[model samples]
Target: MSPINFTHILTQAVDELSESESYKGLFHQHTDGNPLPSAHALCNIVELARAIIFPGYFGNSTVNSRTVTYHIGVNVERLFDLLADQIWAGLCFGGDGECNACNEYQREEAAQLAANFISRLPQLRRVLATDVEAAYNGDPAAHSFGEVISCYPAIRAISNYRIAHELLLLGVPLIPRIITEMAHSETGIDIHPGAQIGSYFTIDHGTGVVIGETCIIGNNVKLYQGVTLGAKSFPLDADGKPIKGIPRHPILEDDVIVYSNATILGRITVGRGATVGGNIWVTENVPAGARVVQRR
Candidate 1:
C-alpha cells in the first residue's frame, strides 16, 4: 500500500479504539418474542370493540339482527386473542417477570386472560349504553342516538376505559395502561384505569379532563372540557415524600354536572343533582340540586 494510505488507516483505527471512545453495543437486554404493541393495533382494537359493542355501526360489512350475534361472537373471539398478545407485550415491557417455560406456555396463559376479559364484554356494553344515552339526552344538538354513537370522542374514550378497566380488574398488568393511553391520545380525555366511575357518565368536548386514581364518580355525572377531578395536593409521607393511595380526588354524587374549565379538588363531594358552573373552583361538598354558577 502507499505510505499515505497506510498512515491514514492506522490513525483511524487508533482513534476508534481510543480510551474516550467506545463501541455501540449491538445486543439488547430484552429480546422477548412477544409482539411490541403498536398504537395502530390499540386503535384498531378500540374500533373493533366499538363495532362489537354496537353492531353495524363500525367495521366493513353490513350487520343485521340475525347477523349481529355472529358478528359479535367472531369479533370478541378475535379481540381476545389480539388483546392478549398486546397485553403480553405490555407485561413483558413492564418487568412483570420472565416465563422460564416454552413459548407455548406463556402464549397459553395470555390466551386464558384474554378470553376471560372478552367474556365480560356484554356487561361492559351495558354500562356504555347508559353513557351513550346520557350523552345523547344531555346534548340537544345530537340529532339521534345513532349520531352520538357514530361521532363522539366521549364514546370512544369511554369504550377504551371500559375495556381497560375490565383488564385492570382481572389483574392483567401493563396492557391496561397502554389501552387507556391510546384512547387518551385519540380523544384527549384522560381517565385512568384505576379511577372508579359508575354508570350514566358523560363528558362533553372532553379535552384536558383529568380523572385521577381513587376518584369515585357517581351515576349521571357529566363533565365538560378542562374539568379536573384531582387531588388538592399530594400529602407528604413521614419521610417528607409524597404519599400514595389514599382517596385524593373529588367525588361527584348522582346527577351532578360540572361545566367547562371547573376545577374540583380534594376528596370532597358535590351532592346529587348539583350544577357546578363553568370556570369555577370547588374544594368542598356541594348540597343536592345546588346551582353554583359563576357570579355575574
Candidate 2:
C-alpha cells in the first residue's frame, strides 16, 4: 500500500470539524476575560461548605467550643470567595454573548447571590443536622452522627443536593446542576438540584436512587436504595419538545417510607405516614397511613 498522507488527512478533518455549521450549538464561545466555571473550584467550594456545616467531622478534627467559631468564620469567608467566582462564571456562561456592561452586572449579581447563600448557611446546617440525625437513627448499623456525616453516601449526596438546591433558588445558572451532578457521579445517587426535600430526609444504601426534578419530599421521609421517584411522561409543547418547569414527579408527605427498588411515577402523592414496600411499582396516589406492596 502507498504511504498514507497523515498530516493532510488530519488537516482535512480539523477543517471539516471547525466549520460553523458543524460545531454550531455544540460549542460555547466564551467572552474575553470571563472565567468559565471550574469543576475543581466547585469541588473545593463543596468541601468548604461541608467543613463549615459539620465542623469537627469534615475540616478540623480538633474543633471545640473555643475554636468552633473561628473555624466556621474562616471557612465561610473562603467559601464565599470561591462560590462567588463560580456563580459569576455560571452567569457569564449562560448569558447571551457577553457585553462589558452585562458582564459587570453579572459580577455584581454573583457576589450578591454568594452573600445570600452564605447567609443561608445557618439554616442549611440546621437542615443537615436533621438529615444526619435521621440517618443515624434510621439505620441500626450507624453508630454516631459522625459516622453518618463522614461515612454515609446519603449525607454526602444530600448535602450536595441541599447546596445545589439553594443555589438554584438563588437564580444562579448552570452551577447548581454541575454541583449536584458532581455528587451524583461520585455517589451513584441522582438528585436533581431542583428537587424540594424537607428536613430529616434519609436515603439508605443510596446507590441507584433517582430523585427527579419537581419531586417534593416532605419531612421524615426515608428512601431505601434503588428507589426511583420519576416522571411518568412529559407534557410536550406544540413543537413536540417536552415542556420545561412543570411539576411531574411524585410528592412524599411527612413520615413516608419508600423501600428499595420501588418505582413511583407521575404527579401522585404518597400520603403522610405511608410505607411503600420493596420492588413495588406505583403510579397512583397512595392514601395516608397506607401500606403498598407487590402482590404475590
Candidate 3:
C-alpha cells in the first residue's frame, strides 16, 4: 500500500478505537476523585501487614526487641492510611457513580473498616503463629520456625489468606481478593478469601493447592501439594447462570490430612481425623478417622 493509504487507514483505526461502544465493559473511566484500586499499593499494604504481624522477618530487618513496638506502631499507622484509601477505592469501584453523601459514607466506612481490621491484628498474629508452628511440626525437613517464616511458600500464601480473610470478613471487597491473588501468583497456591480456615492450618510442599470459595476447613488440618477442595458441580438458576453463594466445596474437620494431588469435591464433610491419601478422587463424605487411600 502507498504511505498515504497507510496514513488514512491509521486515522480510521484511531476513530474506530475511540468509540465508547467498542470499549464497553473493557474501559474504566477515571472519575475526578475516585481512584481505582492499585496493585502496587495493595502489595505494599500486604508487606506492611506482614511486617507488623511478623516483625523482624519482613520489612525492616534491623528491628530488635527494644524497637519492635515502635516499628509496629509506625507500620500500623501507615497501614491504616494505605488500607483506608484502598478500601475507599474498592468501594468506589464496586459502587454506583460518585455522590457527595455516598462518597462521604465510603470514606468514613473505609476508615472504620481499616480500624476494625487493625484491631484484629493481635489475633491475626496469634493465629499465624499457630500456622508457623504447624508448618514446622509437620515438615520433617524444616529446621526452625525462622526457616518456615522466612523461606516457606506456605507461610507466605497462608499469611496472605489470613490477611485477606480478615478484610473480607470486615466487608471490604476487591482488595481482599487482590491480596490473595498476589500470593497465588507468587506461590502457585490459590486459597480463595471466602474459604473459612481454622487455626494451625498448614500446606505441605505448598504448590498447586486450590481451596475453593465456601470451603470450611477446621483446625489442625494439613493439605499437601496439588490438593483441591472444589465443587463437584454448580447449580444453575432459571436463566442458566450458576447460582451464587451456595455451599458447594468440601468441608474438612479437625485433624484431617489431605495428601498431594487429592481432589475432594462437593459439600461433603471429611470428618475429624480422616486422611485422604495422594492422587485420589473423593466425591463422598468421609467418616471420622477413616483413612482414604488410592486403590492400587
| Global Cα lDDT for candidate 1 | 0.83
User: Model 3: per-residue lDDT, tens digit, 153-221?
Assistant: 999999999999999999897899999999999999999999999999999987999999999999999
Candidate 2 lDDT tens digits, 68-97 = 999999999999999989988887775444
Q: lDDT (0-100) at residue 147 of candidate 1?
A: 88
Query: TM-score for all predictions?
Result: 0.83, 0.95, 0.94
Q: Which residue pairs in candidate 1 have backbone atoms (N, alpha carbon, C) closer than 3 angstroms, thus clashing?
A: none
Off by over 4 Å in 2: 1-5, 95-101
Report, for all candidates in order, the number of backbone clashes.
0, 0, 0
- Per-model CA lDDT versus the true structure: 0.83, 0.93, 0.94
Off by over 4 Å in 3: 1-5, 16-21, 95-102
Q: Candidate 3, 68: how far from true, in Å?
A: 0.9
Task: Supply the TM-score for candidate 1.
Answer: 0.83
